[model samples]
Target chain A: MQIQQLSVFVENKPGRLAEITEVLAAANIDIRAISVADTSDFGILRVIVDKPKEAIETLKEHGMTVSLTNVIAVGVSDHPGEFSRAVRLLADTGFDMEYMYAFISRDKGRAYVIIRTNNGQKAAETLQENGFDILSPETIYNM
Target chain B: MERYYQPEVECASREQILAWQNERLVKQVRHVWDNVPYYRKKMEEKGLTPQDIQGVNDLKKLPFLTKDDLREAYPYGLLARPLADCVRIQSTSGTTGRRVVAFYTQHDIDLWEDCCARAIVAAGGTREDVCHVCYGYGLFTGGPGLNGGSHKVGCLTLPMSSGNTERQIQFLIDLEATILCCTPSYAAYLAESIHERGLRDKIKLKAGIFGAEAWTEEMRQNIQEKLGIKAYDIYGLTETSGPGVSFECSAQTGMHINEDHFIAEIIDPETGEVLPDGEKGELVFTSITKEAFPLLRYRTRDICVLNREPCPCGRTHVKMSKPMGRSDDMLVIKGVNVFPSQIETVLLNLGMDPNYQMIVERKNNLDTLEVQVEVNETLFSDTVRNLEKIEKTIAGALQSVLGIGAKVTLMEPKSIQRSEGKAKRVIDKRNLF
Candidate 1:
């Protein structure tokens, strides 16, 4: 299962992140998870949103440089060793992770991690085979 | 005291100048018809002959020659005189296409020198003064042209050419050179050097004859103030003989065209219709007295106005205003016309927003063009390598339209500024005029 992620090009300047958030807020798009890959010049803002397709349109309308990426989400038991287990599963299979970020789920004793690996479909299959929950795009977006 | 090299001809009456032009235009047309077959064929295409063009009024019927015509002819197509009879050749510092090589006979040199002499005298040069000629020599016409003019005016001339700034200042002081000749930029450079050495008191430059590049009135005043001399502007092209075609006299309103040697006309660049005096248009020159290479109705591409307004300098030659700008906004980058509107068309055709910035830089003495377009979804990809591929596609598309490769950079949206009106599309760091 593949999840939709929005990657925005953000210039390194004051209040740029705030401007992006304001645009999503005005369009009633809630950001579910966010990570910033930053350099001295600019940053790549990867975000998971409640409504990704709508968030993309609204952010683009506000003249933001944004693109889509297909990533896989895997759920693990909300414990210290559970976070390590999911990444070690992909690592042992030699599936390189391009980028990965995690967030706690509201459901009791569970957590979700978004991973952009070299192969999204294959990585999802590998995680599911390893007794981890491969979350679908609908489940991730509705989270 | 005001002095003129040839007072009688320089201050001739309107009728006298008109008669001279009519006779010369008639003779020059016949000369081109009988000798320059390239131009003869053009005249034949128009169903015209030497007998058809009687005076300057009939001059419009002849087809205009452009830089393309000169390049098409290449090294020898436009020569009117045989190589044996031609004594020398001078060329433009052409950054585009084939360099224009103009052949000159001994007599042609004399007349050209005489034109330069008029400019020197207009700048208050005299036999008692030592004139410094710093314009580059060899192929380029500036140094040689002014050097010959200074000699003709009987000024003890120093053919310094350009560069070697310390030596230039040395000669300026030791020789007490009264007249300076070079490009305005080089003049400013010399002034800066002179100031750094703190030898302004030792220098004795009275007037400067600066040309071969466009300059501002403010630059003129600045150089004049720095060097403690009255600076004058001169204009000419190798195609019409160098830096004495027109010169700003002491009157300083505009430059007086040497109408006796060349016929100048301002015409609509697009329609080729000649505009009346005082209307801004493309300047076209017809070399009437040139014996070795007589070009008729040659387009100069410099947009300026001609006025017959009486000059207090008493030189009756019609004056031309300083060049305003080019007739078109096309930029010659690496010898190709890069029009911004054409880039817009290319981007529009590719189904993308044309909001972009064009950067011109000079590297290794060569011009480079770079286009940075704002990234849109259509051109963006998650992978950095894929984004580079998208940039290559834009560069390839621009090359297809511009005939020259441009470095393309993908910028974030809204990275380029867009004012309320007339967005600046180019950032030129070349320092070219």
Candidate 2:
């Protein structure tokens, strides 16, 4: 199964992230990994948490605008050529990455890149068929 | 703003307004009988003429010119003057079919601007203030009308039009604009933008006179809090005169019609029976002093109540409650009449943000309604079960208020698409045509 991500829309103001974090803390939803994609008007607080559905619900209950997205987390050899080769695989497969970011694995020798493509199911099938390592919810949770 | 048009014949008392309206009503009746053949014929059919009308009290005797009349006349049949004599024309595009257009002479434009100037004054605008007109320009009548009024008031004006958020902010900072003129929806957008940009400290805007669309009190408070300004409501239509027919005075309870220039009447929309003041009904306006396109008792179809109580602002003009949903804005879904304002009232009563979207669709010949509400961060929790419960609660609220079941979809804050002009609240996909 694809990993569910939470994209929380927050006004670009100070302590907004802290406020969101406090709500999650109280809810006991552990944030696995989070990154912020910001624009001038507002910022998208993209979060990968242990419990995506629960996190989304809690955030919604707190009056936050959040959406759940299915993304493929690709495990790659922590090398420059490997990353380039994986991107080429996506390009050759006709799948465009809407957004992506790298997260370090616990071993530190291997790296994981979380990718959100326009078509998640097709991209997942294509990447799987191409022998590329597309992550599962269990793999991401363990990492 | 108030200084812009201290009526050339300012009547400070209610008695004066009645006297002025009575005189104008007599003259307008006679003028309609003489010039406008359509009004003359209609009045003659009703066994009424200039001789049958006495004064303002006799206004009820005149038959109202409904929008159907405007449509029947089409382009120029309503004009009381020659085409060459008319200086301006304003129109509102209807979602149903052809746009409604009204013409005006130079004197008419001046009088309209004077009414706008009265609005500016009522909102505490001054000659030294800077007015930023954000209402749409061109055929929309709001921008240019407010622009003319600001100039007449001697306020340094920024005719910014609408939707250049960055440039509008820049002007507000550089020019220290004190008054804002725009639709309430756009004002909310600007306020949201200013808050996001953290420019609230730099923006000098103190008062906003918003119109051209219907808005709720919750929206008013939200805009007020975000912009640090007192938000005022103005009511008008291109069919009458733009932006200045009635405006919220300092009291902020209701809008005071420039009763001296226009006669206001409440009439039962169904039976065409004129209702007494203080009763809720369709508002009708008769342009008393207008020369070119003086509408004799035009039915505006704006539903609101009238109050003749004296305002603290020392004006005796009859005040109108901010017009509720337009007669045309009413949505007939599954044979049930619904107004978006009713949903707004429910949302506000629930302590939820008024930002909502109504999706209407037809499936298997049955109407389906979905209301997507943005989750307020203050009320959300990080749990799946709780979010579903909140969604159900919202659905329950919707069902109770609307008397029709709606599938409630919880949306992320700022995710429903903020509108800068008219808030797109409905998506009617019934294909009923």
Candidate 3:
């Protein structure tokens, strides 16, 4: 139930994000959800794309430093407590979440949270056992 | 205005100078041959004796001493005089490898200070001026050399070593220090600092004698314009008794070597054949008057040419052009010879700070060069694509100059280490052994 995410190293300059998006558009790869972690000098642009392997190859061909990381996507009911329950479950199990970002799927009436934790497989198992819908690569990419 | 410090020696006729050189060179060779066995063995290995060297023309017959020999000898192997006769020891900055300690007797010190005194006098220093020396003291030769030279000139000497920029400026404005002496980079920094503080008019510096590091003419112009003074270039190395081995006259041409005391030569670095005057080659020096550390035909490794044409300043000593680059510091990447100064020239011409580092590594048996350049505020604020374009521009410039491609990595401001002494500009990680 682990999903592949693309992490692109981007210097903090204008047109960087636009350049990445233009490259993805040219490659016909869709970025489903994107988040940026930024410092003064550079930023890490993390994206859950429809095609992980292809996206990585294209970005690497563009002379960008790119890496693939394993993350878990969870589908939760569109409610405040529903999001907190998944966070609370991981906290209760003593598993630390390194970072997480979420986007609401209005048509599906659910909020999908992408989480990176210390242990991906164990966190997925715990979330599944706690009555949370753990996303598969196929399901997330198809979404 | 008095141009030559020791008019009798500096303005001596060519024949007179040659006579003095031949006499001193013969004495110095015999002195080293008898006292410094380390070099005497080098002479013996070549199957030669002091009797074989009769005059300056026979200098090429002697074996050349390099930094490696200095390291091998360490402290006392090259000392030509007894310890009791030696008065002090001055060392190289030793940024590259082992430190080279040079012993100086009182007479040696006196002559060295006289060389520096000549430099100061050439730069318009006089007995009434206050000479401020900011080169590092204690082990480094710049501060001590210029300090003693300032004293010799009868100037009120301020032995202010490097750093403490604020205090340096304070004294500059307060005491009206007329002549400033330090490394070229530090002089540039002081000019920058003074300009930033709007204290240009307050600074009473009439001349600046800058050396101990390589600086471009553009930087010289920048420093001169900022400080409103004539910046004179001084040349020396610790192996040959510090700054004042040569110095620029008011003519602003090449620096005139103190040929009365040190005999200078240019040689093909690879073949060790002495190159003709005006041909760029590695510089070599033979100390004729130094009593303590009398090095004969010592290889200096600096690449430059000697000019014998009549200079406007009228000093008869042969002048050496500012060293273009060092033979040792030139980087060979992928069969292309690259000097850090070339890259620095490109960056400075592009209106960027010259702070940069060249990292070389071997990957899959191919040498790769990566130039990490610090981005100033102006460049840092540019769009990412624009920054990338700038990197590409720099890479193209470097390729055209070096005949090899290099990866340009833009680093954040203040990321590169700032050096107070000699700047370390290259990091080669290739295991060539």
In terms of DockQ, the best-performing candidate is 1
Worst 10 residues of 1 chain A by lDDT: A36-45
* TM-scores, all models, native as reference: 0.68, 0.59, 0.76
The deviation in Å at residue B355 for candidate 1 is 5.9
Q: Tens-digit lDDT track for model 2 on B1-433? A: 2332575444366677777888988987887788888878899899996988899888888888977788788778787888999988987634222456889999999999988888887788888999999887888788889999888888998989876679989998999999999877678778888898888999888899987666668778989999999999997878787889998877889998888888888888888798988888989899999888889889887889999876676667789997764556666454344567767877887788887889887553346788877666654543444556766787887676666688877665665655695568888875432
**Model 1: how far residue B265 lies from native, Å:** 2.5
* TM-score of each candidate's B chain against the true B chain: 0.81, 0.76, 0.78
Mark the regions of model 3 whose C-alpha exceeds 4 Å error after superposition.
A10-31, A40-42, A49-66, A81-95, A125-131, B72-77, B81-87, B96-98, B312-314, B330-433
Q: How much is the lDDT of residue A41 in candidate 3?
A: 53
Better of 2 and 3 by TM-score: 3
TM-score of 1: 0.68
What do the candidate models score in CA lDDT, each in turn? 0.86, 0.79, 0.86
Q: Which candidate is the best by TM-score?
A: 3
lDDT by residue (B1-433, candidate 3, tens digit) is 5466798988889999999999999999999988999998999999999999999989999999998899889888999899999999998654223568999999999999999999999999889999999988888888999999999999999999987999999999999999999877678778888999999999999999988766668777888999999999999989999999999998888999999999999999999999999999999999999999988888988899999998778789999998876778765464334668778887887888887989987653346898988765455431245556778889988777665688888765444556785556988786432
> How would the docking of model 3 be graded?
incorrect
Off by over 4 Å in 2: A1-143, B1-4, B7-11, B328-433
Prediction RMSDs, each to the true structure: 6.8, 13.3, 10.2
Model 3: lDDT to the true structure: 0.86
Q: On a 0 to 100 scale, what is the lDDT of residue B373 in model 3?
A: 86
What's the alpha carbon RMSD for model 3? 10.2
